[model samples]
Target: MADFIGPRLYACYNCRNRVALHDDIVSKHFVAGHRRRAFLFSHVMNLVVGPKMDRRFITGLYTVADVECSDCGEVLGWRYEKVHEESQKYKESKTVLEKFKIVKDNW
Candidate 1:
């Protein structure tokens, strides 16, 4: 994970819409797409602008906010947000691994 440290560029694999996550975020980041309970709580995930969210399924295990590419409107991934669950407070965004790529030491 040391290789992940430094200036990183997070881009949507669909249209290559990119966002920068600096060293600080890199040092304390989480794998957004992991299925484990611990993986869903990471807060260092990058947020890209211009991408829109669709909550077609809002009443389920988790309130899903489907995210898309800002330019081409491709399916990037979904953000699992905690809704109506007072015991568990969780909100995390995940970009599809096949639909997104991270380039470390970008600068």
Candidate 2:
């Protein structure tokens, strides 16, 4: 017999709704507002992207939208809609999930 394993995922802390896959993470050393740790993911699922707005961060100014869990409407993080700095262009379309707002699943 063979052992079975599933894809590692990150779920919303409030609802356990799977939001992102471990494989989609671009960086795990990101810092969110209020000095909170966060993860940058290339793709995410089961999330509701809120209104787009310009927010200034340590890196630079960016147009972003808050991403909430579809199941419970909990604010998980934000998605980078537009990058104003050329050096930070790679972050466009990426999602940043707060570490405290997510729990690990299937791992």
Whole-model lDDT values for every prediction: 0.41, 0.97
Q: Please write out the lDDT profile of model 2 over residues 1-107, one tens digit for every residue.
A: 98899999999999899999999999999998899999999999999999999999999999999999999999999999999999999999999999999999999
Candidate 2, superposed: residue stretches over 4 Å from native: none
The best candidate in terms of TM-score? 2
Q: Report the alpha-carbon TM-score of model 2 versus the true structure.
A: 0.97
lDDT, candidate 1, 3-105, per-residue tens:
6544555555545566334432312323344431112223324443332444432233555555454556664445554444554333434322222343333
- Give the Å error, residue 2, model 2: 2.2
**TM-score against native, each model:** 0.44, 0.97
Q: Candidate 1: global Cα-lDDT?
A: 0.41
